[model samples]
Target: MFFLIWLVLFLVVVSFLLLLPASWHRAIYERYSGGRPVACPENQQPAVVSIDVRHAAVAVMDGRPNLRLSDCTRWPERSKCNQECLSQAIQAEPYKPGEVKAGRKQIYHLPVLLAAFAAWYVGAIWHSHYMFREQWLQAVGLTHAQVKQIVWWLSPHLLTAGVCLLFAYGVAWLLAVSHRKGVLQGVLMSVLLCGALIATTWFGIARLPHDLFLIEAGYIALASLTVGALVGGLYDRLVLPSQ
Candidate 1:
């Protein structure tokens, strides 16, 4: 019964994700498509700007839609001017020189990279000889000798590192898009994302032993929390301020 319920919820979530992009694309195109008159931030002169609606629509999946001018009346010669008029065009606000508009938040690369390394390190410790190394080997039906024979690049460690990096970037993207800062918010977002992962783990329940499933899920939860705290709390409070 639990599995059936989970399956239904999973389908609903998947359908929502698949449909959201298309809905966003249509809405964005309807609202921002075609040429619109915008006051240029450089000289405060009136200019007709054409936005790349298709590009902005596609970028909606990344949490923030990137607005770029496909063509401007002052193009070819004055094209080198920064496209600050985009904000004015969308918000219907007068261009203010030197004033930063509230738009896409910058993703901090250092924090994201550190978060990925931390997650990878947690996995390394979790699977080491002092931890579940023997049990994991047994669960996978692989002997120590067979495990040692696998090439370094072909091993799970490299895959884990890659996955951790991607997950960290995803967390950063979520934080940036949602304008969520601090450790608590990070943990909350990470927990929600991890819940999705745990739900998918149900599919492998029949194939994996209970111990193995627990071992993997436990590591994922721990790593996710660590990343959330580091990126959300530490980075936001310490690193972001210093920058």
Candidate 2:
């Protein structure tokens, strides 16, 4: 059955997600620490250097006059060192990629609103007479009168928008954590998340009608894609790295 195929695919996706964290860390390490051993600087003890694509930091070191601010915060000793020493030593703070970029106002209103509207729009289209509304109702064993009773007011709309906002927040958090700001990356992440979450719930929990599940799942994936694209595009333009 179609459901069986999706069930198998969901398992594969889950397995892949389970392995991602380890793989991401390994890739980062391999990229930064080449096969060759790193040699310590003359007269300096060996230290761990945390490296990402943009920067690297030594674990600890004595204060030096010529060291740049970016270099200063990267040193591990900066955290434990005396405040006076640190103040005289470094002018700039540590770089936190997820932190709000310097000089750019943090605003959730836009992404939240955008996501809410998009989600509602997609749901409306998916459930309208133009799409699968009747099929979905039949698959779910609900009559048109029942559907009307459920949507006779704004409560459902408000709830839908609220859920959409929460989902947007989750997407934003993931994109922020990964520090990835691209349409493709966002779309990929959204697809992965949407599939994982919805499939897991649909398969693991109580049985759902196949058509009904498919209808709902399709909307979720589409809405997530829309929200992710919006967030990623806006982030690139709105979030500027410190000078």
Candidate 3:
């Protein structure tokens, strides 16, 4: 499995998600006997319409108003997000009519996404190291054992990428949903949110052993944000009849 393979898989997953009918997310959660549309609370629904809402939310809430420099380097013993930010989060978009409103918009689905990212990381890291090992071996390479060690070394980027995904979508929703922001605004918000995520994690995270891995993560953040933002803005622009 090469990085290209992993990247293709990532794109494929997203593409399949797109084909499943625009309302598939709501349908997946609806799972009720009644076929009638259900009303979701503002929180239970996606704050925005994009496919990547989960990522936006995590990126938005990655830090506190007063978190210390030290905390950035250390992973908290447990997850805690209640009132993590001083400012009131912009409200999520209104639930579609007839949808029951949940108390809070699920702006981000953290646990589910973490699981997904971890899976991707393992796959990508395995692919990257396997290739590295093969080249290293053919050239004058290291042992299989050494290859495994290299895999372990690159693990931090995987974890950091996952962390960055945490809040990326929540941010998109904050602007596009709660604030009813225009496409450009939503895209800009998402870009800034992602930029903040890369900066905070790269600077604050402890034990990032590989500098190239760090560079790759930074580049990935930029790439992912650009993709996410352009997708959103373009989607919005295409909606106009004039366009």
**Least well predicted 10-residue stretch by lDDT in candidate 2:** 64-73
Off by over 4 Å in 3: 1-165, 176-187, 198-214, 226-243
Q: Ranking under lDDT, best-scoring first?
A: 1, 2, 3
Indicate which candidate wins on TM-score: 1
lDDT, candidate 1, 208-232, per-residue tens: 7878888987898899999988878
lDDT computed for candidate 1: 0.76
Question: Per-residue CA lDDT of candidate 2, range 101-136, in tens?
Answer: 322223334655676688888998999879998899
lDDT (Cα, tens digit) per residue for candidate 3, span 1-104: 69999999999999888776445434423321111222223234322221223332223333311211111001122113232221212222324545543222
TM-scores, each model vs. reference: 0.55, 0.53, 0.30
Residue 225 of model 3 has an lDDT of 49
Prediction-by-prediction clash tally:
0, 1, 28
Reference-based TM-score, model 2 = 0.53
Select the stronger candidate by TM-score from 1 and 3. Answer: 1
Off by over 4 Å in 2: 1-108, 203-206, 238-243
User: Candidate 2, residue 221: CA error in Å?
Assistant: 1.7
